[model samples]
Target: MTTPQQPYQAPSAEAFLMGGGGAPTAKFPAFGTTVSGRVTERPTVEQQRDIKTGDKKFWSDGNPMMQLVVTVQTDQRDTSIEDDDGRRRLFVKGQIQKVIADAVRAVGAPGLEVGGILSVTYTHDGTPSGPGMSPPKQYTAQYTAAATAMLHASDPAAASPQYAAAPPQQYAPPAPAQQQYAPAPQQYAAPPAPAPAPVAQQHNPAVAALQAQQQAQAAAAPPPF
Candidate 1:
């Protein structure tokens, strides 16, 4: 018996940062420009086309030319693009695509995903090979893995604005107030003196009379001597 395959479930639209509406497309108009943001959607491949002619473009080898589309939530703003909702849809093609792909691979990520960070910078214009051909735009890219980005985001201490503005001040709990506990001097207590023993009294009358008679005989014998 063959095991049944699980049904495919589509990701939520919010994952693409499309909860409100479609994100505005980003454009790079100058060299040395950069755009960085958290990726809100996985990169997708799409057919490349000419914006003016609305026709499909092909590579020199006659293969269908394609582009990578990535959606991100960024704070960077571009005057050329009207939408300033901070969400941008990046269309990566030609040299830029390779740069981004290489960056992702270098970090050992299979591909870009939501929660990952992507930064792309247009470094300079490349020299054109043929006459009258426009120079290609060169780009540099950087990527942070989703897990690493999430760790920074989820940590309260790391995500604090104060922490980013400056290195977190080392928190040394004030050395617990030293308590100088001096033992109080014990009072000197002398043990109470024992009570005096009681003296015994003579109670026998006969014994008392014999003692008196002996005393009388001794007195008389002394006088005769």
Candidate 2:
């Protein structure tokens, strides 16, 4: 039974991007609700892989393609997230996914490794299946950046211990261009410092006084005179 109501289309890729994944605007409510934490688990990706660019892909407006099982740290005894809420998102096609992917990569997050600080603003509204069908699998509200923030904020030591931008094995310090001169460990310790040289004594006042006394005694005897 098709009713004569305005079609409620899901937001577009351009819409998400333009909004900075929902940049908290005055018109829109402040992103008071945030994800429990940064997304630690990798994104679950689906849909026809590589269907050639430029072709239009199908979008199930209400169905979520990626169900992000995110960890929320809130102790909401009165809320739905008593256990864990999957901050799922939908990707109509590979292209649209790439659009968001590129944006995320540009964010320069330290790492997406689980247990990072991931927070976002999302609405609690559910998407209904169109006219005659049952509602598709429901999901957490559309997860989006509350403001212009990264979905993955890496912990401080992430870029250091876990992975560094520099080449050599991951242990290398973070200097990109020039080699860092870090003090070597026990095995590679630097050579020990040299000892100071012994200084010579130039002013012997006691020796000079003794010589003068002997000379004065010989002169007083005056044996030659």
Candidate 3:
């Protein structure tokens, strides 16, 4: 028989960001560039609600809604100049979303949710340089420092050899059953007779003998007391 699935409460971004019993740190790949400073903007909350009870649609693996906005410095190369310095500088921005499993594992919120934002610069159509001059220039690019900082946060187990292998199967050994014997024709045995009790009473020999005789007579009779 298939086991019924239970309703899952997605953990909050804070919980995931702040691992249980510890502080939360980003686990994604790093962003931003080597040339300029990388900064983290304060985190913000986005409220979500469930539209249906026991909704399987949202229960399946899904990405968190949280993402980050990253800003990075980029420069458009100036064909007019000779070296790399000749490039004209410009700022670029983009958004990065959260992974589902990681989000669900986060702390505060329950259900699939994401936290964080995308860094500034991203790839899009345009010459490496500023406003069009026809020969579209290209520039060397790198992730911003903020974006790069989380490079290893998401994958804590990647370095382990066991992470790549298949999980082990769990099977319990069977238990032994009770045995039964064939019934035989019945025969009953009589219980043993009760043992006699000793009497300690007389001061005179004559009285003692008489009392002993009386007690013996009482014991010989059928048990009525």
Candidate 4:
């Protein structure tokens, strides 16, 4: 049986510029000044071309020159770079690449991704290598991951809490074992009380007889007097 082909979906303008398997019919102006926005397209590398001649460019080593492109939904209006839809395509190279790469590394991410927030500032111009050539532009950049950016966006209060304040549930240490103390072991039984001492019995029969005789003689003498 022959399988049916899937319908082709037209790529967005942002996708077309970011090397998303689309023809380069659209041209997006390079970022001229500082811009801040949420990333709509991930970073993509494409061959650099001459602006005037529309010919592929190469470096001194004969390798094809490459440029990194990223698309962002801008936060504010900037007529210079952003399109009518408020999306700006960042054509990153040379000094700008180093700045963005350093920022990504600082955040411990592999690279920029969709839904992330990116802010790039054109700080100043760099010293030119030759007299006739123009000076290179310098830049500084900052990035926030998608998850972190979304968290802050969804709940503004979430950003105020520090990581140290609330550790992840999985990483939290188990509660310390409850302090346990056992009562002193009870004695099996108290020692039995000492046996009472035996009492002595009077065995003086002779003294009893002498006392009876003296009492009888005194009675007889009193009657005579």
- The residue-by-residue lDDT of candidate 2 on 112-220, one tens digit each, is 3344344343333334557766433221222234232332234444434766466666576766787779875545333333333233322466655665666676556
Q: What are the runs in model 4 whose C-alpha is more than 4 Å off?
A: 1-32, 78-83, 156-225
**Per-residue lDDT for 1-225 in model 1, tens only?**
232333354544664454543578776789887889999866666667788997767767567677877988889766765657688888888788899999999999888988999999989999997999999989999999999999988987778866544558887777778889999877755433434333332456666666667666655553221
CA lDDT of each prediction against the hidden true structure: 0.77, 0.38, 0.35, 0.69
> Order of candidates by lDDT, top first?
1, 4, 2, 3
How are the candidates ranked when ordered by TM-score, highest leading?
1, 4, 2, 3
Per-residue lDDT of model 3, residues 34-126, tens digit only:
222222333333322233663322223453232322222223344444443321112221112332223223433342212222222222333
Collision count of model 1: 0
Best lDDT goes to which candidate? 1
How high is each candidate's TM-score? 0.60, 0.24, 0.17, 0.55
Error of 3 at 22 (Å): 38
TM accuracy, model 3: 0.17
Candidate 4 lDDT for residue 137: 71
Cα lDDT over the full model 1? 0.77
